[model samples]
Target: MNVFRLFEERVAGALGRLADAGDIPAGLAIGRVVVEPPRDPSHGDLATNAAMVLAKDAKTNPRALADKIAADLRGDERVAKVDVAGPGFINLTLAPGVFLDVLRAAVAAGADFGRGGVDGPKVNVEYVSANPTGPMHVGHGRGAVFGDALANLLVFAGRDVTREYYINDAGAQVDVLARSAFLRYREALGEDVEIPEGLYPGDYLKPVGQALLATHGPGLLEQKEEAWLPVVRDFAIDAMMDMIRADLAALDIRHDVFFSERALSRGETDHIAATIADLRARDLVYDGRLPPPKGQAVEDWEDREQTLFRATNFGDDVDRPLLKSDGSYTYFAADIAYHRSKFERGCPEMIDVWGADHGGYVKRMQAAVRAVTEGRGELDVKLCQLVRLLRAGEPVKMSKRAGDFVTLREVVDEVGRDAVRFMMLYRKNDATLDFDLAKVVEQSKDNPVFYVQYAHARCASIFRQASEAFPGEPFGPQALLAADLARLSDEAEVEILRKIAAFPRLVEGSAHAHEPHRLAFYLYDLASSFHHLWNKGKDQPHLRFVNQTERESTLARLALVHAVRCVIAAGLSVLGVTAPDEMR
Candidate 1:
């Protein structure tokens, strides 16, 4: 089904055959050989770097090697022409029937046309584990969208994926949230409560307070602070998690697991203590006096020896504290236990999608996973860079201190979940995204979501138009797939067929790179081709879909349309975006 992979295999086979016949050198490495679309379409259907990549290794001139490889490949039934271009690059143009067959396969497969091989190992994708103290913001949205898309891509690529979120309810921030909600609850009870400076001041917590007052009435207020803190803390944490679940549901994201950090060590289960003991057995933990942290030094820095993990043994910058001087396990210690849980869950391959602000944490976390899994498991950390809010061309300051921070819900409400998800993934995860509230909602090509969605809509319009034009003619997938595709020989029609033929290659490439943004880019290119063909029909009467005089031409064009629609649906499904039949 992957034409590019097939082509590469055939080319490599030819090279191996030549070597066996003493036409070429033996024992040449072929793993690095790659075949891809030429930068300029006019160059050929596909380009291979086999000659250039193998020349130095084989002790031969690149051009001479390319000529030999080209001569060997010319005999392939699928390869109609082979030419050696500049710098020993070999461009191969396949027979038009090859592309036609690919389009037919796409029509036959429907939305499953481009589903590629999956990784055999299980992958745990942990994302959007933002602190449960407040609502998710635009930054969290990026991580959520990126992580969800990655999980989808991996599953499509053949990995057993477990989408998970690590709850931060056990952190100091949630304790602050508890105090903040207590203040609001007192205020809701008709008391004059002064909001503390370091507590949450958002109006969103007022409901949590009111709910608290309704549940406990005046009895919670009568209780001393020590007795009520834990009660309110758990209540506020639960409410915050409820809000987060709703927010994620709004975006169509669902997690397979919600790991509670508090559950790791509570009630004598004591997995954190067990994990630390296991590390100690391996000589990875010790009570050591550590050097001061760089940048901002802690004024309360103690010279006393503290329990520390030898994180440097696994490539962290320095040994890290497992338990602080306050007799509580540090966040890193809990993280180790959490990752240990993933390994226990049989996740041999893992990916953590974190915000860019947590960039410094990646090395330590990866190091921990390595140590815990004894290098048996691999961890890939994808850090999403910050998104800058913009209105038109100007930067929109979003300072929470000034009470102007943009929440994820606000962005989703304004531009809608589809636009928000698509835009969030429209760029590389490590690259900064400029999310403009006004521009993304604009119905133009500049807005990629609209352009791609419009392509799907246009294909639907073709089907609808066909239903009116050819009422008795069959327009189902099977009918179009059985259409006379040989009639689709026009130069422009062939171009569209060629683009559709590249969908499998695109999927394989993007999945291999672990980059979903590549899918967005490829979708844009495919949509451009669809749009251009549509515009071409406006100028050339013969290119129109409703060629009343030629039934074969109409059927051929309909086949192409179905193929486009199938690819769009497949791509959107991978991105978790709905392909609307009509854009209302």
Candidate 2:
């Protein structure tokens, strides 16, 4: 049960009654009202800005309105007290029994505990669109986990989600990949091949070389570059993409769509021309020359009135170039077509996950969507800051030149998927994360994944103890719901109940902000509450699960334990982490 939402409704309803009774002015909008926990918990259980928001509109003093709202809320059976704070904020203290009731709802809902419905709109989360050049690295791993968790959170909050990966197969990078693999194919045939500097130098392509030998040993050697580039390019890209797919599978991330950039232009689809034409018709495209970039500049930069998108009109730094001087479409051009394809395919609400190196590119891409959709569609870009790898508290250096850049697979193999996923999302996506190989494997509170998982395991231990305390007592929903929860009046028990009651509000806020790290924070808080209760049980025998003398009390405590497990498990599932029943 969402106690915050319930309290918000009561306060809002009371305000409307006051307006109708002429105690407050009529026709004031209350849509922007919010209720949240106070920063200082000692102030109250919850706080609302209803009075402050409505005061100016109602032409009434905020403090006076707050006093009237407080008086109205005091009449609520669920609210034990309502006090007006400074600047017209209302602090609500809920009845103790209401918290126990929240525990009952959490137990009844189980794994489905905090699931909410979409009151806004559907969203498309496109992530991990790494180039089809090589295996995904530790950098891509962060975006993949963050995007997946965010998508899961959106889905849990009731948004229809589409997890997508845009495959950049039709680029210069893919051509380089093809030539690199072809060189390996020659090496497989025992040819004296000197590796070139511009091509891929990683040893990861050895398997691709071996596979090419198995497919066509001697025939491709005599073929001209023109005749062989296409065949080898297609084969090598397929191999690289397969490797990326396997890497994602290791982290339990499966996208709903694998959109290909090549498919937009290479096929008879002609989507590029179609998309450009659509914008051109709207007078958003034109032939314009761009000023030379500041500082570092391209050597071959030529001044020409090239085809450009009117991005400046939509708040970009400059009108973006759509075509290179060589008459080939630029990367930005292809991206426009890609986003247009998303809009045409009914994904007007979209989010793209990218590395923080691409921060400067966000505004231009967002401007593209606005120019194309006429502000009809929304595009959110979540940029994940770099992940600095650590081992034993020291920096772990990566060498692209040494051909030993650590792959995503190696990180997963070292720490396992759950640790990798949790640590990746443990921080805000915009904040750089230091992922330590040593600390993540530790089974302690310092390690968030283990701490959260231990909470689940501790709850499981309580259930085991309950099974023994009441040998024949069933752990079914009906039996637990009927138990005398009034006996769970301890401060620690009530604190945990309060945490459980905050789940729905947490989900709503996370969904609204499109921030999945909020889930990580919530899980940390919930786990802390569970751990506190567990330690309290050690000091107070009555707080322990095995209430031997009282069968009803034993069942009631088990219900709370089981409820905490339910909330944590559901949250971990959203984060794509395993909630172990027991931690070894």
Q: Whose TM-score is greatest here?
A: 2
TM-score of candidate 2 to 2 decimals? 0.97
**Regions of candidate 2 where Cα sits further than 4 Å from its true position:** 295-301, 397-404
Residue range with the least summed lDDT across 10 consecutive positions in model 2:
397-406
Q: Model 1 Cα displacement at 207 (Å)? A: 0.5
For 97-190, candidate 2 gives per-residue lDDT tens digits of 8898888899889899889845756678999999988888899999999999999999998888889999998888888998999999988888
CA lDDT of 81 in candidate 1?
91
Question: How many clashes in each structure?
Answer: 4, 0
lDDT of 2: 0.88
Give the Cα error of residue 216 in candidate 2, in Å: 2.3
The window of 10 residues in a row where model 1 has the poorest summed lDDT is 396-405
Which clashing pairs does model 1 show? Answer: 117-157, 118-157, 118-158, 119-158
